[model samples]
Each structure stands twice: as C-alpha cells, then as structure tokens.
Target: MRPTRAKITDAISAIERCFLRNQDGTNSVKDSTDSLSITEMTELLESLRGSIQRAVSVEQTRKPEFDIFLLTFQRWLLTDIARDQALLCDLLLPILNEALPPSASITPQTAPFVEKTLQFVRDTILRCSVAKDLIGKHMIGRLVATAVCVHASTMLKRQALDILNSLLAKSKENKALLTSHTCLTDLDNLVHLLKNAGDVELQTQLVELLFRICPKPKQERLQFIDTLHLPKIFADIRGDYFHQDCRAFLNQLNAGNDGVLKTPKSFRLSHAECVLGDTTSSLTLNPPDGADSLWLDFNTSSLSILVMIAGGDILSIELAFSKVQRWQVESSAGAFLPMTPIRI
Candidate 1:
C-alpha cells in the first residue's frame, strides 16, 4: 500500500529526532551516529539525500522536512561515519546541488539556507583531502556558478568563493581540474555581475576569487579572458579609492602587473626606455605609490595571469603592451603587502 501522510510524518519525525540537538547540549547526532555500521550508514545516507533531491524536484523547499533531511545528512557527516570514501562524496554531491541549484529562485528565506548549506559543505571539505578532491572533480563548475550567480545572495556567493579558494589552493590536482575554458566563462560572468555593484567589499571578494582561479601559462587563458571585455566598466570604477584593489587585480590580469616589480615609477620608466619607437610613450599609467605598491603575491607558478591591456583611469596601472594576443605570466612573488578586495 502507498504510504499515508501520517506514516510519512512519523517517519520524518523519527529521522528528525535522530539529528536534533539535545537539551543536555552535547553533540546531538553523536549517539545515533555511533549506532550505525558502514553498510547501514551508507544506505541511510542514500535515502536521506535522495529524499532531499526529490523535494527539490517538487519545489518543496518551504517544507520543514526539507531541512530535516539536510540535518540528517549533515549530522552523518559530522561523525566519522564515512570518512573520505567516494560513497560519501557521491551522496553529498546531489544533496548540495539540490540545495543550490544553478537555476533556482532564491527568496530571502530560502537564500540563507542555501548559503549556510554551502558553508557547511565548505567546512566539511576543509577537514578531509579525499573529500576535497572528490568534490572538486564534479562540483567545480557548480561552485563557480554559485559564486557568480548575479541574483543569488551575497553570502552564498562569498561562501562559495571561499570553498573554491581552499580547493584550488590544495594542490596541482584541483588547479588543473578547475582552471579550464568552461570555468573561465563563470569568471567572466561574475565580472559582468559586479560591473555595476557599488558594494566595495563584494568587489574585493571577486578580486580575491580572480587571484585564486586565474589560469596558468596565460596562453591557455584566452578561452576565458578573451570573453571578458570590461574595459569601460573597469575604467569607470578605477577612480574610486575602494576600487583600487579591484583595479589592481584587473591591471595584473590585463596589464601583466602580477606583482614582482619593486618601484612603480622606476619600473614604468625602465619599461618605457626598453621599447623602441613606442607611440604610447605619452600614455601614462598611474602606478601605485612608492611606499605601498599594489602587488599580487601568488602562492604558485602553476597559477598564471592573463595578459590584459590594462586601461583604467590609473596612469601607471594602465599598460600598452605589444599585441602578444594571449601571453602568459606565471607569478611566484612572495613577501607582498596584504591586500583585500571583494567578490564574484
């Protein structure tokens, strides 16, 4: 016989009881979590995650059981129940995707849940390498989309960017897997999203994201960079003191100032002196101040910066280089000033 609403309610209540916080204040999921064997845990996880996926399909996000389901899966993760196995990764991916689907309407109430859900996943991955790599393989695109989704909540965008930053930093594996033309499109999309955003902190976060996902061997960057043409937008925002870091990031990606230069004024002079018959000798780039220059301290050479013809209102920041088309500049410049810009 088909299950009645009463039976389903009872089943849901029972699962909810397993995950709810205790009045005693200990980790509530601990006792119930301790009771499951690997096989039983796996089966329960599949069931819970599947229920969530089904709820998402029906647009039932308003229901309380939607949260109950996520709580159950999240509680299972809080324990050592499945520790980095592909099975756990596999189960979690669908639940996460359902939580923040690329094409979902995000109302204020639903938005926080999505943002918090992403934060939970990010925190979980931070604790396990196997989980990090596994999720990176399949979730990179979705995460990028989340970070750049124009209509999505800012908290969601920032949180998704944080997770991407960590995964991309872990090693060459994630860098190679994530830095592709497909992924670059999302970066471009984010740039467009923030083109008119007045929120300085959000703009700063996007700059941070750019530093994180910037591809290596910039020759491989065209598929992404070429598609992003925001010269006018960048030019408009460059004058704002709050936008200096964002301008610096674009200057590096577009102008090749990915740090490493010692003195901005002198560097410009030397650069000008080197070029024979340069028409833009008159073209001025207002570089950063001598005491505090805008420099990018990338952690790896595996990370590459795109060759953008940087042209915002800032003089030294703007560059007129030869038409190399898509030249790559890899930076390993350490010992740089700490700078912060906002998001994608």
Candidate 2:
C-alpha cells in the first residue's frame, strides 16, 4: 500500500522532533540516550537505514516521493541544529550509495541539501576525534573522491582537501590511500588553485596541507620547490622564506646597503646576483676581516674589497673599470687583483 503524503510528512516531522528533543534534553527518542539503554546510537542508525531502504524498495513508480524523503532526511542529518551520533554516519553510507543517481539530477534548489550532507560528514570528521577515526576507518578516500567529483564548488573542494588532510594527519595508517597517484594529483591541482586563485585563506590552508603531506626529506622539498614557484610568489610578502632570520643577512645585502655589523665587513648587491650567481661571486662587498670572499655585482664586477689594513686603518677604494677584464696584481691593502685588469 502506498504511504500518503501526510503520513510521510508526519514521519519526517516525528524524526525531526526526535532530533530536536535530543538536543533540547527532552530525550524522547528511545535510542541510547533514553529507555533503550542497550540499543546504542548505531542501532538507531540501523532503524533509519531500514526505513530508507523500505521506502526506496516499495515501488519504482514511487521513487520521487522516496527521493523527497531521502533528501529531507539527508538535510536533517546535515543541518538539524543538533548533534548527530555515529549511528547517523553508519546509516548515511547506504543512503549515500543509493542517492548518487538522484543527486546527479538535483536541481539548484536541492543542491544545497546535497552539499550540506557532504559538509556535515566532513565537519563531523573534523570536529570529533572519534568521528574522524570512524571516517578514517570507513569513509576517507572513497567518500572524498565522490564529493570531489560530484560537488563542483571551490568551497566543497576546499572542504574535501581539509578532510583528506585531517585523515592523513590523524591516521598515518592510510598512507597508501593518501599518497596514491590520483589523490596526489587532486591535491596538486587543488594546491595550484589555492596558490593562484587569489584566495588568501584557501592559500593559507593549502600551505598547511602541503606541510603535512610533503615528505621530510630535502629531496622532497626540492621536488616541491621545482614544481612550484613559491619563492617568487612569497618574495613580495616580506619576512616570508626570502626574508627569514637565517636569510636576513641576504635580504640586507639585496637591499643595497651595509647591513648590521655582526661581521666586520658586509656586502651590498642587487637581487639578480644573489639568486643567479655562484657562491664565490655572490659574497658580501667589503668581506669580513680574515674572510676570503668575493662580492661581485650582477655584471660580475667587484663592488668592494675588505682586506685587513694595519692598525685598523681600512681604506675604501672603488675601482673604475670600463670592460670585463681581470687585474693580476694585489692592492697595497692585500686584496687580490684580477688576473687581467679591465680598463677604467
């Protein structure tokens, strides 16, 4: 016999009332929180599952109404304004599998309903350690791939990334799934979007993801570096990697000014020399005392010489050279002259 619209509405209202009562301390539902002490949340979830299954199996011709009920149930699961239990997640699995076909045909009005269902699961995994563990055990890669393929939104994509990241972090047991080529490919594409899509928060989140997923070896770091031009992107964001304290000396040198004198002599140069030149040629101008270094400009010209002067009588001598050549003599200041002196 076909269930009337009024009957279905009443059932939905009853379930909603249970949900609200659970939240508001009424405890009307006979699940774990009430008289059905041994029943557990999982059992309640099973009952919901049986109901959805029976509704769907009644008749193929009645699918639309069944779908409506299923959609409403999903909406409640996602955003009931009450906390859901593990049983809800267990009940959701079969429904998710069954709802795929109908979800594909969902209208704009119904899209949020479907999306909220996915968001709820993701939020549960993120918010509760036990829920995350349950998802890591039961869902993880499978549902994540479904969400990524079915829900085409930047927000959903970000949520999927977050879920994957959390799963990978909490349970290193899923390394094979997390590191699979397909998963990595999706992550790579998402990282590209975050890095280039003008979304600062997304980019920040992606950076954290990268730190979590990227391996701890220098080779892996170099591999990531070679793949993306993060240095260039972060260069303008002063005090990032380029301006770290370890590289503060380099930043000062690039600023074309004598940086702090932690060392007796300092070099000042342009960005090009620091990034492109060899180590020997990229040294600081006025090399520190007892320091044998060359400070060459981008044009490969010596900027200054820091040779020891007797009794601390240091001389600041600027060589004027017109062409690329080497001087073969040492200056009176004990600095090495180029092999072939250039005309100045």
Candidate 3:
C-alpha cells in the first residue's frame, strides 16, 4: 500500500525525535534517566529502523522528501548517536549494498559518507550473519576497489580485505570476480599496499588475498601471476610474516614445478608437479635442524593455503587466508615458534 504524505511525515518526525532532547536537556532515546528503559530503547530503535527503511524505499522512486529524511538519518548516525554503532552498521549496510550501488551518485561530497558506511559494513560482516549475506556480486568489486583507495584509512582498507576474505570463503564466484580484469585498479592498489603497508596485519592479509585470486585455469593462472608482478613487489618486502609464501608464490610463477629453499649455507631446489584443480600445489621441505618437516598446501580458494609442520607435536599455521592463523606449538627454548614453512 502506498503510504500517504501524512504517514511519511509522521515517520520522518519519529526518526528525527530519536535524536531530539527533552525539556531537561537529556537525549530522548539514549539517556536512561529520561525515562527510557532498555526495552523502550530497543523498541524505539526498531521504530526508527522501519522509518529509515520506508524512507529508503521511497527515495528509490526519486522522492525528495524521503531523500531529505535519509540525509538527516545519515547525519544522526554519524553524529547524534554514539553507542549504537551496531545499529548504524545494520542501517547502512543494506543502503550501501542495495540502494547506493556502484552507479549511485557519489560525488566528492558523498564519498566520505559512502566510505564510512563501508567501514561499518566491513566491521559488521565478521560477526553479523545478515551483513555477511548482503555481500553480492555487485558489491564485491567495489569493496576490493575501496580497499585500495589511496585516501582510504588503514582501518577501512584492512576491514575491506577482511570482508573480502569472508566472502571468498563462501563461494568461487567471489574469487572469480576478484581475479577478473575489472579489478585491475584494485590489484594495482593491492600491489602498492603490499609494498607500503606499515600495518603488519594489512600486509599479511594482502598476500593471502593474492593467493586467493590465483586463477585456477592453468593458462589464466600463469597470466594472472605475471599480472601480479610478484618479484618486484616482493623485492621491497623482507623479513615479514609472508616472506616464505611470497617466495613460494614467486617460484611457482617462475618455475612451474620447482621451488627454491634458502639456507644460510646454500640454496636447495625442490620439485612438486603442479596439480590441475583448485588445490594448485603442495610441497614438503626438511629444515636444517631436522626437528620438523614442513608441509605447504596451496589452494585457489580465497581462504588460500595452510602451512603445517610435523615433528614431536603437529603444528598448524593457517595463513590469514581465512581468519586468524593458528600457532599452537612452542620450542624447548620457551619461545613460541611460528609455524612457517622451512623454506618452500
């Protein structure tokens, strides 16, 4: 049913009142002493969400009044409210994902707003199933592009990569979208980020993302690695969490079936016949101490590869390919030895 203008006005008024102050100068929705209990607060938030949804639905048809209402609501989310970040994320995720798609009228004036909303979406998607489900094909490329925007904050960029990691875990279509030429600019930014990432976590995630984007088709995968320019990118990065994997990625590109293992004494060459499916290649290497044998498993999926070492205790270090890397093994020296490939 079409809502009358009076009904729309009432909805707008209800939303506006969420940020309004009482005669005592206390906030109506956020302050407890103003006679708003937790249940009342939740009910009020639900009412405001409905009003915002209605305004968003109306704005789709070029309704100016609802557009104004949306602008006002965005302002409230940005300023008027403080503790309801979850609500803000829930409110903005769908609007950004469904309403303001890549074709939306995002001028310089609105770009900050769009980016901020994406940051919220990035933070929410990890814990909120609804936000995770909102990620579709239309949003995937944009999110990748957003992650590498030169002006984007490190927090936003990392969150964007994190969100991509989650989506890449869910389906191959997301991985395909990332590998396509449409993300050329994104990949460029990714290379830039890889070289310049002061944030260790950010750089680690970048490598994992690159692994995820490795195209499964043999010809395309070779072309994609060439497009990555891994050697040039790796030259600047050293002594980082992804050093060995970066070497392995480069070796895989340069020599299809052989890998290089570096020791203080000499460099040893190892071979593994590159496989034909999603699981691209696996290599096992022996460390100098002969304490543990390292196993490296590479996959084309977004979650990327897992590096495991076997000795007295089985140790697993999952690359940021998924979530957090697991490190459960320690050395007799009383230090936590990171579970990395010996050299492959």
The candidate maximizing lDDT is: 1
Ranking of all predicted structures according to lDDT, beginning with the best and ending with the worst: 1, 3, 2
Which is superior by lDDT, 2 or 3? 3
Stretches of candidate 3 above 4 Å error?
Answer: 1-94, 97-116, 123-134, 216-220, 232-344
Q: After superposition, how far is residue 22 of candidate 3 from its true place, in Å?
A: 26
**Among all windows of ten consecutive residues in candidate 1, which has the lowest summed lDDT?**
263-272
lDDT of each candidate versus the true structure: 0.51, 0.43, 0.48
Candidate RMSDs in Å, in order, are: 14.3, 18.0, 15.9
lDDT of 3: 0.48
Candidate 2 per-residue lDDT over residues 162-207, each given as its tens digit: 6666677755555455556656665555545543332223344455
Alpha carbon RMSD to native, model 1: 14.3
Q: Write the per-residue lDDT of candidate 1 for residues 112-221, one digit (tens) a residue.
A: 55775676677664664365667778677777777766677666777777777777775566777665555666666767654433333355566655555545444434
* lDDT by residue for model 3 (102-207), tens: 4333444445455545655554434444433346454676676666666566676776787777777756777766666776777887777765554434656777
Task: For candidate 3, report its TM-score.
Answer: 0.41
* Candidate 3 lowest-lDDT run of ten: 259-268
Shift of residue 221 alpha carbon in model 3, Å? 4.0
Per-candidate clash tally: 18, 4, 0
TM-score: model 2 vs. ground truth? 0.44
Q: For candidate 2, what is the lDDT?
A: 0.43
